[model samples]
Target: MRPIVVTTMLSLDGVMDSPGGGEHPRAGWTFKEVPFEEAAYEIKGREQEEAGSMLLGRVSHDEFAPVWPTMPEFEQYNAMPKYVVSSTLEGSEWNNTHVLRSLDDVAALKDSDEPGSIIVHGSATLAQGLATAGLVDRYHLLVFPLLLGTGKRLFSTDTPTGGITGLSVLESETYANGVQKLVLDVVR
Candidate 1:
């Protein structure tokens, strides 16, 4: 089975909302609040190199589809298979994009013979659903040092009833800018 890896940016408080500027008042809090360190973002390049495909929720797809295609750093993802889970999205102008209607579709994809990781980025709602359904195999979190008291969070009340535990840390690092990179495997 292909591993579904959830990769996300988070504040110390766990808010996963608007790491990249958006409609939220705390939009762009990641770069705005924390200092930048090139080394802290090295994982992004490695993720692109190792990813077999990409998965996203409708909101994240809408937010990234237009912008990522134009950025040199995101060029590799433009050609990769991108599955967007949405019932309302009719189509996408993004290259190699597919729309999935339900979590069942996601499960089927994970069951496929696809190699490498199915990387999930910036899709908090979809990430939560995947976790609740016990579909995620691993997580890549770049945690900033600050806290956003009010915003969408990654580990919230919606998590699995007992809450997530048994995470095996695969890799971890703290950058000079105080940004932390945590690569954890969700132990089954």
Candidate 2:
């Protein structure tokens, strides 16, 4: 089966929202609150290089579609196939984008003979669903030192793990700028 990886940036308190600017009051906290270190963002380049396709939820798709395509740095991702999991979103104007109606579609996509991993960018709701349904194979997390104390978290009390899910750390590093990179595999 194709691997599904949830990749995200989080704060010390586990807040994962508005790392790169969103509707949150503390949007853009990643750059504003934390120091920018080139080494800290190396994971992004590696993820972009390794990911075959991208998967996003309606919110992230709406947030990224308008800006990512215009940015030259996102050229590689802009060319790859993108799947947006949204029941309400009817269509997409983004390049090579496809709309998936449900998590079942995500499961089918994962079951397909697709090459490389499906990298999920900024989709907390979808990530929670995937994790609860036991679909996420790996996680690429970059945790910053600052804590906003009031944003959407990566893991919450309501997140129901189907069973005892263990995460084995595959790789880890603490960047000079205090960002921690953690690559964890979900042990089934």
RMSD of each: 1.4, 1.0
What is the C-alpha local distance difference test score of candidate 2?
0.89
Q: Model 1, 56-118: lDDT tens per residue?
A: 999999999889999998888888999999999999999999999999999999999987789
Please give the lDDT score at residue 172 for candidate 1.
100
Across 8-57, the per-residue lDDT of candidate 2 in tens digits comes to 99999988999878778899988998889898788888988888899999
Residue 27's lDDT within candidate 2 is: 93
Q: TM per model?
A: 0.96, 0.96
How many clashes show up in model 1?
Answer: 0
True-structure Cα RMSD, model 1: 1.4
At residue 87, candidate 2 shows an lDDT of 90
